[model samples]
Target: MGTSPDRSFFPGSHWLYFSVYLLAFLVGLPLNLLALVIFVGKLRRRPIAVDVLLLNLTVSDLLLLLFLPFRMVEAASGMRWPLPFILCPISGFLFFTTIYLTSLFLTTVSIERFLSVAYPLWYKTRPRLGQAGLVSVVCWLLASAHCSVVYVMEFSGNSSYSQRTIETCYQEFREDQLAVLLPVRLEMAVVLFVVPLLITSYCYSRLVWILGRGASHRHRKRVAGLVGATLLNFLVCFGPFHMSHVMGYILGESPVWRSLVLLLSTLNSCVDPLVYYFSSSGFQADFHELLRRLRGVTAPSQQEGSMELKVQKEGEGQGQDCTVQTV
Candidate 1:
């Protein structure tokens, strides 16, 4: 096979690549880990249905963050993969896997929330935690299975030249490779992003209509921010990566553009914790306390006092206010 029109990712502005990935690691790691720890406590205290999905989202982001340093090194190495050949595809596989997992989990969260609010009567009648766990497990399994294609395709001589002496993780794809890759990715974008995006949009749109009417301005702002942030994440971060695949398939891969878009996608990991903090009690409590300690605030339980946080009662259907909109 001959080389495609695009030889490789155009190497320029290495500093920008290093900075974006570094920023993701610096902010995403501690916050996601803290969310996990706090959620563990919350799960033990009283498990909320959405907590399972949110926990999985945090885990997925954390997994993605783990790969950023290796990616940063590759960027610094003039966009050449300096790591082991095996590790390249593995990291790439994990990267794509976790991102789609985040999408599916977010979709599930929206659906669960819609059910809880739309039909609270039927929702409270059953055990929700078990159902949520089942959904979480299924999403992970499905996303992982779907993402196996990355490794399979890699081994197929599309991504790396395993047969040759050179072992690159992500190399320029030829025309034939792009022919196979583009359709697969377009399909994935539909399943992983497009469909789920529509589902989440419908769910959140309806929820906003229902929940926004009687809610306070503060509560409305939190819910609105959650919706806005999630949409912004998909559109700004993940959207271009997939769209680039479509455009690249049509116009040939611009490795530089794709690489830059991919970096932006990782920023979602850092942004998700902030979304979780404003939308969940456990995340808020942990983050608020961390900020207090950082600021040298000595008052105990001061977060609750200042925030005037409320909890969901046994019979309440609206959830826990802004924090109640955990989706």
Candidate 2:
């Protein structure tokens, strides 16, 4: 059998990975946090079933963002397990699990949106909120279980750390381990990623065809934005990771692209909020309200300033009237 991929450092690959992950964390965290607050506020106002799933999606993205510092530390230390071995797998587990959960929710949101527009009657009969919540719970469990494999896959047959400070976590595995990991990783990329990509593409395509005929220009624009953002998230974030995994499996060499692709995968947190904002009317309204609140704060200051100016002008006129009377 062919040997496993070369696990050696690719010159500046570590530095590049560290820098990109830091950038992704900086960019993704605040956006996902904003989305999370918006989604939570939305849930309080009214119980739109779709918002539940969108809320879950936002939370998933946030979860992924939470673990980025660990990865950055690993990269900064030249792929060494700088932290405890237990923590290494925990970070790896959360990273993949949450990202995959995001994919699942994105797919679900697309189908939900398409159904509401495409088939209103059938959609009404469906339990939107209940079903969304159930599916989300199920996905969370399955994703957690799937990611549990990270620890097993990483810790087996190799010392968790090297004689030097550097060691692999999820990045590299032994040649003997390749046989088992190859099939599993390939299947996951196909099932978790490729399947969702195809489903969202089809759902959005049909939505365009159906909505195109009757939807107003504004409505169509909204649909297109929603569809485009969803596809772009997968294309830009998950697509590279999916491709790299399969190619690495076949080539038996972990390429430099592996680190880059993984970093890209974390970007879903940064982009998924855009999807939430554009796709849902409630989210947009919430965003608008948040903007209004910010503007409202300044509004009072302006109002107070005007009132102060009017009072000063009236006092000045009274003082002049008194001077004129005295003269």
Candidate 3:
């Protein structure tokens, strides 16, 4: 059976991991929930394809954030799995599954945007809302199926360690375990990470070129922000984790630094809100409206009548914009 590492490569860094996880949980949870509310509200009024995809992306981020406290607990225990052994695989499955779901949903959103801009006439002819729902379901199934390997490797029956003896949740692969895990990891890296990344890159590049030719400066800037955030998410948050998959396959063991790089992946949950803000004018309008209402609530001395009138006008404006640019 595979053996656990002799010692954590960064013995004193568990606090760092815990701190980052705490911060991400605090920030990502509310943002994603807010995005969820906004998307649901918009969809209830009028269903749009991009909004459907964005809603799924918001849900993916929320799932990742919800399962993150498990990691936080493990980190607080200095990267040890102190909880019941059963919790490890459950949380790990949701954690890894949702991470890849983010990649797929983001790629789907990019494709939707690219098609809307690059082939507006053809895009309109399709039944987009139904298509987006189908795509979302497929992405979830694909990621969940791929990540189920977590359960397989964890319970391979060859491990010498019993539940009480195992120190880590998903680390310390034995030779037999590594033989199966490493190849699967490499395949996941190629299929889930690299392929979606290449597709996103191509779609965004073509998107920029198409918009540059005749789109307004404001439109171009919004697209630029969306593209930049999505790519930055792939490069900064996910790049290192998947690279570790490749490196682990080649080295025949998980790298000592693999745990540290996983923190970057956790950070993606917090970063996805920026993508939501930039990708949808409806989200921006609703977000700003929420802030305005909060301000009004806090400052009761402000003329209630005037504030209500302003909000009404802004809502009307938002409705018009949502009709034109729901994507």
> Which one wins on lDDT?
3
Residue by residue across 1-327, what tens digits does model 3's lDDT show?
A: 333434556557888889999999999999998889889999999888999999998998898888889988988887788888888889999999988999999999899999999999998778478888899999999999999999998788844447345678886676888899889989999999999999999999999999989999989989989999999899999999999999988888887777778889899889899999999677799989987887889777568777899999999999999999976
| Per-residue alpha-carbon lDDT of candidate 1 for residues 157-218, written as tens digits (9 for 90 to 100) | 54336443333455555566666776777778888898999999999999899887786776
* Model 1: residues with Cα > 4 Å off, grouped in runs: 1-11, 157-167, 252-256, 290-327
Rank order (by TM-score, best first) = 3, 2, 1
lDDT of 2 by residue, 126-155 (tens): 756778889889878877876777877766
Q: Which residue ranges in model 2 land beyond 4 Å of their true spot?
A: 1-10, 125-127, 159-166, 295-327
**Is candidate 1 or 2 superior in lDDT?**
2
**Candidate 2: minimum summed lDDT over ten consecutive residues — where?**
1-10
Q: Which ten residues in a row have the lowest lDDT in candidate 1?
A: 1-10
Superposition-based RMSD of candidate 3 using all C-alpha atoms, in angstroms = 11.9
lDDT of each: 0.76, 0.79, 0.88
Give lDDT: candidate 3, residue 170.
Answer: 88
Write the number of the candidate with greater TM-score, choosing between 2 and 3.
3
Q: How do all the candidates rank in terms of lDDT, highest first?
A: 3, 2, 1
Off by over 4 Å in 3: 1-9, 125-127, 158-165, 300-327
Count of clashing pairs, candidate 1? 1
